[model samples]
Target: MDTLSSTVQAWAGSAFAAVFRGIKVVRPQRPIHPKGIQLVGTMQRDDGERQPSGIPWLDTAGTNRVEARLSRSLGLPDAFPDILGLAVRFTEQDRLSDMLLATTGPTGIGRFVLRLRRDAAAAVFSSMMPYKSDTGPVLIAARTIESPGKLPVDPAAFRSLLGGESWTLELHHATPLGAWTRFGTLTLKLAKHAEDTAERFDPVLNPLPTAGTYGWTKRLREPSYAVARGRG
Candidate 1:
């Protein structure tokens, strides 16, 4: 996007951020996705030799401890459909990093569509926004691959499942209009005292290694992230 457009978006986003900050002030909790469960996992990143994502982290093969959180966007009742989110944090090249994903379509035009599902494990989780890479731009995506059954939306039930069973997800990278290419695998289980985990994931502030920030996409997000982090 052009600088002028980014500036305009920044202004509008800041206004929205102010409004959200006020809500958080009143409730003193997450501005969105207030209910969630923490997960601990291992991320096995594979170098995509065939379709390199142009991001060093994904292009380099390695394994890292991963921390993740799953939540309902609206904190809706367990039986109802609501947008779902997956927030992942890890270390890359010794620096803390994060990737925040939400339910979205998996292909072509659908990739732009935000989807809602009652079962968190059944929906595709996407970056929702693309990252500027050396190869141009790319989106990261994940979907449960070897789940035992449909995972409920309730944080309580979800935590129970996480305790006894391991959940696996295939990680992929794709251009906005291109096909997805596998780059990693994530296996998650419940962490000790996960219910008390209060870690925050912020891609805008703690972006993935070797990914471009301060670009058009980040401009659209910085305001809200700043406000949410109590920095604005």
Candidate 2:
């Protein structure tokens, strides 16, 4: 029985990895901080099912906050089939801007969403869906920023507070009925955070080729125009 269990575990792990194989982030856009970006959006799946949900990674506690509307008619390029749509917001406070990143998970496969917000002010929050399986606890690791008093805010400081160049969002799942478990790790980078600049704010989605892949090395690198132009 022990040997049988071990073999099953190994197979389950391999199967999980295989499902996530060759998943490359072909398009990575810069983070967009629109003045009135919407927080709630309707996600329309390829199967013609529309589900209303808050942007997974963003906070939507306010009543007057902006809302997002998504549809297949938006027509993302083929390279970004996994990402449905994104909505972001930036608030102008005093002389600084607070950034928020919100995105929906791939349609129809799994119901998942995420949001990230940052500002010179001291506050942060990250939440995920509550589901249980036989494996273990599924977890999403996130970071928050807070300063007791007024602090000099710099671009690098903001980026570092957001997890520097090597930050990532992890989706951890424990073993269910099988001997093995399943999980996914998505590496994220503060690709670009422009403030009071002439350049238009663009959000990039660079999916890693495989789970557990790192994006620190590429975060500082210039974003590929292929993604930017494709959306255009």
Candidate 3:
């Protein structure tokens, strides 16, 4: 964006963030997606030879142990079609990395729009924003490949979705208006774990190798995330 528009966006976001920070000081809890389950899984990146993403780490092939979370954006009731979330955390050598996705349509412009879904299997999660690379901007996306069908909103039922079958999301990356290229896969299955978790994620703070945030992107997200971390 140009300087004028960018400046305005930054100013607006920072102001909102300051307000959120104040509120969080009073009652420190995640203002959104407060309820979620921690998941253990593996994330493997492919060679991506067909359509190279131009991101060095993403174009290479490797696998890493990952921790993830699945939650409703509003933490709404089980019967409602609330926007769902998938947050993945991993490490690249020494740097901790995170990528958070939300339910959105699977298309050109639709990829940037969040949608509501009653079934986890029915939702396609998008990063909702792009990460900057040397080539251009890239967006990451994930979708359930195992078709778990109706995912439960209740804690007990949501945990059950993992054990009986494989829960997998195909990981992909693309430019703002480019074709998506499959670069990896995230498979989350049943493993011994607690029902509630205190782990937190911040993509802006712990971005993947070869991917970083733009000034506007950081301005938009940094505030609320600081509040989430119990920081001002």
- Quick one: best lDDT, which candidate? 1
* Candidate 1, 1-232: lDDT as tens digits: 5877977987878787887788787646678777788888899987546678888778889999999898887667787898999898998767999989999999987887888888877889999788888988889999999887888878777776665788999999999999999998999887777473667688977888888864667767888778777777
Candidate 2, residue 165: the lDDT equals 35
Candidate 3 per-residue C-alpha lDDT over 1-232 given as tens digits, one digit per residue, 9 for 90 to 100: 5988888877877787887766565546776777887778899988635677667888889999988888887767777878888888888888899889999988889998889887777688899788888788888898878746666655678777655566888998889878888888998865465776677888978987887678888878887787778665
CA shift of 11, model 1, Å: 2.7
In model 1, which runs have C-alpha deviations exceeding 4 angstroms?
A: 1-3
Estimate the TM-score of every prediction.
Answer: 0.92, 0.21, 0.91
**Which 10 consecutive residues of model 3 have the lowest summed lDDT?**
22-31
Preferred candidate (lDDT higher): 1 or 2 = 1
Model 2: residue 218 alpha-carbon error in angstroms: 5.5
Q: Pick the TM-score winner.
A: 1
Worst 10 residues of 1 by lDDT: 191-200
What is the full ranking by TM-score, best candidate first?
Answer: 1, 3, 2
Q: Give model 3's TM-score versus the native structure.
A: 0.91
lDDT score at residue 174, model 3, on the 0-100 scale: 89
